[model samples]
Target: MADVDQVRPRQAASPSMTARQRLALGLLLSAGFTLAVDFSILNVALPGIGADVGLPLDGLQWVATAFALCAAGFTLLFGRLADMFGRRRLFLAGMALLGVASAAGGLATSPAALVGARAAQGLATAAVTPAALALLTTSFPEGPHRDRALGLNGALMAAGFTAGAILGGVLTDLLSWRWAFFVNVPVAAAVVAIAPAVLAPDRLGRRPRLDVPGAVTVTAGLLAVVYGLTAAGDTSWGDPRTVAALAAGGVLLAAFWVIESQVAAPLVPVTVLRRPGVRWGNVAGLTAFATETSLVFLLTLYLQKVLGYSPLVAGLSFTVLGAGTVLGGIAGPKVIGRIGGRSAMVAGFAVQAAATLTLVRLGPEPSWTALLLVATFAGGVANLVAIVGFMVTATSGLPDREQGLATGLATMSQQVGITMGIPIMSAVVTARVHGLGGQGPGAVLGGITTAIVVNAAVCAAMAIVAAVFPRREALTQVPPAAPPGT
Candidate 1:
């Protein structure tokens, strides 16, 4: 593995170049914003989409799952690509592809076509995410500056989720569900224009052989695992398709690991995974995101179905949770800087778990208390706080040269969290919600409560693992401010 500190690039973005640098950062964040918009915006629009596309409930879930599965599968692939080629090149390519795919999704002819387009859109993200993060991490000095940048990046997701929920409802009600994708076109166009001018050009490091076989294996493995979990809600565990996807996923991933261990130019450096901080960060992120994302998924559905909310109201209902995440993401760095990363992570986890517990008391009847929303919102905020801390902690130790790959593995874990969350929670909910005739709302509420409780348990477990976070390093206040090499 490349030594991170040695390879960390110094920022030439200076007094005169501050505007350009900020623009570059903003554009990079736009990529994140676009992703967030897609992620949650679909939650509110699913009903309209299903109606337009003539999809059943299970098929409707696929609309979302397909994007996540493909996105998660390709996360490492793009990460490796950025490492092999150039991070900036891939970033630009990803933007172009994302824009094109977004347009295509808006124009999709059939449900299958839309699903295919969404998957293509997911692939674009696979390219942009790691590369964009690498650029920011390598561009700045590791301190308050970089921390603020990361915080802003985290804030984008919260803001984007808020936008998505509201926009999803507004578009579906006033215009068309396709407007969600259409919205990205103008934003992406603006970014593409400024990116090359503002962002530093990509420079390739060690030209390691691309691990095509390993990439294929891991991709297949992730796809299988995600598919199996997603199908668990609609298909029996005994079903042949479910079994094959899961088994194949397992075999492919195992083979990939074996191949990686033996190969000199492995796609994912084994050493990085062995690093205590990196390993635990991934574990913590995966579990935390899974629980939190599942709550969003299950509750969004229930708000619409059980609570009898329109898409607009359901989306607004999520706004409270989105606001909490934004606040958490924005404030996380300051807290970390004052105390430390570990403390912030653990404290944030506590807040999130407490928020999850708050959701357990939700019922079939509406309450104006706002505690549920506030608690869930706090959980969302805590999520960003913890995850961003995890990112800083995980990547801080790596040398500048390998930041792209490091960012890849780190970001991919979040994708895995979301991918796994939906299916597992759905399956559990469906199983329990059955056999309740005429008490549909009660059944749905029961399922949602169970999922949130499980999510809470996941957060609690994360707190335990966080206790083992390596020696307290004063967390970076802003990742983008870091000197190229920490």
Candidate 2:
């Protein structure tokens, strides 16, 4: 990838956007927030849904897995479709589908029905998310304005995930788990109702042939990989079924690369992945997302199981993190404006690494008043900064035609990191506890601390990687075009 100093600098005289453009950006950000919320909203609702629908634990796990499989699997396909057809049309369709799916999930009477509804929600998210991102990147010219917009987008996305954890628990306790899914209905309806008026229509471009084989292979591969990873959490990673699924997924993905090399219009062109910025930025994004999420997952367990806090109280404690995330989001653009994307990203990673290291002080009798709260808040802020910086760098130099692919790759990296992180980290915690050889509080604390130390090491490694990345000056410099296609 090009280093920060290598890209052409933005012209001193940057043009301003109209009021309609600002409104369009707001609508798109709202869409992003809802989709992010939907990703995690069902997590806390799992136990309740399982009881109501008479699902065993294995079946219950699939309730969340089903959504992830479809969402992560189909995102590239929908991203390409948006490029072929129209982003606005796809966005509206996705919103409609999500509204319907949310309602179905809310009213589901059987496990099959709920799982199917969750899958539908995932498919809808695949469409809605990439379209919204592509639209935003194309709508705003790349400069300080786009940087600020993306900062808010990254903020809302992180905020939504954090908020969902708390909101899901609240809704499940006060009303019903069903209300968690139901909550998206009105939000989707509002966005769908207003989108047409605020967003500009895409002009007809030469549509490419849909790469069906590539899409099928990739989708199947992702499904298998996600299933394997999810299974590894419950059963041993050495389990035959888990091993088989992972191997199959690898084969399919290898086959997908072969198909892409020969196809007329590949779903994800190999050339796109070859870009240094895109490749490294996604690597940074995946690392940041995985480490941050793993930290949160371990924190929740420590608070509830080890420290004897209620689920609701543990969830509410994240408010400090949430506050820091929002503030960090607001500050990210300014940081980028000063230091540039690469430097900002490296700094973010460094901050988060330091924050994670602080949590190594965690003990059997925790000090929530000082150490825990400070580390949590710092991690949140650093996470948002890294996220925004990685996103900005990844998609920085791409043209409008490739915006969908760029955003799709960025989003996919995040999903894959999250889907894989928890299981892997949980396994680490489990092995550590087993080695320590006791169920006592001290042993439990040792295990949690060990897992966090691993997370800290990962963060530190990513920071080193980010620091060593070659400068790509093209990322900071804005193109002269005022509109997307020009």
Candidate 3:
């Protein structure tokens, strides 16, 4: 095994974060949290939005689908744009757009209006996520400080999703479903207001020309792919719409590959993909997100369909898992410092697999204490650790100039994983239930159990892959971040 230092030289020294830097970090995290929350915030509100707007079920689904498609599709394009233009400039523009879109969503009276707003919000998110992450990576030189910052960012982002789930229910019940969208307005406003004061301005020089053909083909390809996967979840892989969309996406992506090869300034530079950390690290990230998200989906079904928990109760139950994620996020940087990112990531996946497997023992009437809480909590912790480690590994050796592209690719992996995983697992659960020849609680339990096992298997397999791959070395440590108020 090689040392991380072999892959990339260490910085001269670890610097303590200034108060302004801390404020900047906070702003970036706030933007990330808002994006994460929006990803799931509308889930519970979907039915309400449909009813109030008199939307048909099919149209209602677009509220979520539009966001997923646009966010996943435009991320890479915007990431490169941030690199070429300016991260801070892109960040501010994204936040402003997000705020406007949120307000539009809240005031929407028609299905088309609402879906359009969601799509705009997704576009803004695609812009903001990579730019904010790039700003963070560039602002904090790689070392313990960078690792710690990334860890905290991962933790908060995960927590934001959980918070959105619970808060969506609360807002829908107490006030209105529109509150879910309205809530982001103030958060975006604050971030946009404070960001310019704290974040360093982007240094402009002779910038490379944009790769228009590569950008267009890749973005269109990603949109089609994500749309197909999203449709697969609602329909089936064999559905004509799914088939056509996926085929079109593949063809477009192939064209993108050819364009990138020939272009003077490719949207995604081939050299970046050649890095062991970038390649294998994204694989780890994709697997980590896919399995963990599928587990959550299965658990939601188990809690609601089998155990008969209310949607609100099921949402609240995962708070334990969210708490564990928070703790793991706090501990992740330290663990990576001790063992290296590769080791920590492998261990995180291994532990997550074991934790997921424990739930295979769950009966129709299982002990929530022994099974649900424990497993979820442990899985949550392991999931965040793996995520943090993956990010650290993926961006480890990249120059500041390329941080936007790296972070964009990293975020894109996550969105693709989340979009792809649920559908695949849903297919598995459906097959298992049908094979059992029943629609009763017993069949549901059996199907859920099978899905859980599959999730564990996937995690274990990825762990083995991460362990066996020798493209990169373990992350090297530096002096820890200075204690607060020091």
Candidate 4:
């Protein structure tokens, strides 16, 4: 196997995006949007799905967990496959699989069938996300153009989640819960059809051998960890299932590390982790996702349980937060260009910390105009700004060959953060609520306040970490574009 860290020639800066590049970007962004939409679109429709399929509450929960677990577990493995085989090939296959899985999910009549379809969807997503992102980073030269593209990508993804939430409710009411799953079918088909014509062809290269042991161990470990975390949400951390899963995961991961160090062609080169950009960028991304997702959960609870808002009303209230994120995505690239990614990241985190702190002021009385909207909106903006910065930072200065690995690592951090955040905060809030007597508005508010305070402290600490760490050079700078026609 060829060494992944071999130095390559750097390309001179390109002037602007060609028409083909633009089309390819559109297809990539569509894939991202579809994936993000799928994640949240089922949230409001879960009850309806459970009813139609005769699923119990626990079975209904698996509808979401199956997707998250598979996606988180297989992302790194698929990412490495993309790098070794072909990113474009992997991307097209993923899209096709997603379409097929979505169709199956929509047609399902039983709980097992629907859950199986969801797991397939998650696997497809794991393949598509890293491959699409890797294609983007490689195709777009790392600079203003790439930054702009990433900003739009971030914005659309955030918008997709928000749109899914509202659209899921509407579709479930107007038609059926199945419509939420059916929606992605057409989108995926369109991308698959158009992508071949528009996107650049994958370059033919020597096929590097896979690190089978590393692949098996890491995938198993991640699945175990994600399963344990998900289980912790429903039961206590001390539950036997959770404890066993976590312990197994820890052992597997440790074994994976040992195997990677001894292997000649490791799945992930240790040097990649040594790079300050990749290391701190992932840290920032994980922190940002964890805190922001927790904030959303807390706010949702506050809006419904405390303020007595209808689910629809609470969902609508978040439209402002979505709007704020879009605006931040539009501005994030420009801000990074002006101040650099590290500085932009630190600033975004600092602002996010402040915004989260302000949420502690929320109370039993509705504060839509005064505190709630402003804080949520600010939190959304800061969150995206931080997210965009993290992506730019992580992908920067890496050669095109390793883009898949870099993106996979970054995306895995995001999935893990999103998976873990709600559970951790739930545990905290449960403890605090019980301490203060129990489930009343005042107790819930106090519990939420405690969680928000912890979230704010985490943001603040990460900001300091980003600021204090000196940026290190990548293993190798991004290589120049391949000569035309090989």
List CA RMSD, all candidates.
5.8, 4.5, 5.8, 5.6
* Clash number for each model: 25, 15, 0, 1
Q: Which candidate order results from sorting by TM-score in descending order? A: 3, 2, 4, 1
Q: Report the CA-based lDDT of candidate 2 relative to the real structure.
A: 0.84
Candidates sorted by lDDT, best first: 3, 4, 2, 1
Locate the minimum summed-lDDT window of 10 residues in model 4: 1-10
What digit string (tens of lDDT, one per residue) describes model 1 on residues 424-474?
Answer: 888777766774543477788887777778778878878877764443321
Candidate 3 per-residue lDDT, tens place, 30-81, comes to 8998898898888877888899988898887798889999899999999999
**TM of each candidate vs. truth:** 0.89, 0.94, 0.95, 0.93
Off by over 4 Å in 4: 1-15, 368-370, 470-486
Cα shift from native, residue 372, model 4 (Å):
1.7
Candidate 4: pairs in clash: 11-480
Comparing 1 with 4 on TM-score, the higher-scoring candidate is: 4
- Residue-level lDDT of model 4, residues 235-276, one tens digit each, is 878889999999999999999988888899999888787777
lDDT of 2 by residue, 8-118 (tens): 445254567679988998899898888888877777778888999888877888888888888887887788888889888999999999999999999999988999999
Candidate 3 off by > 4 Å: 2-7, 12-15, 472-486
- In model 2, where do residues sit more than 4 Å from their true spots? 9-17, 470-486
- Poorest stretch of ten by lDDT in candidate 2: 469-478
Residue 427 C-alpha lDDT in model 4: 86
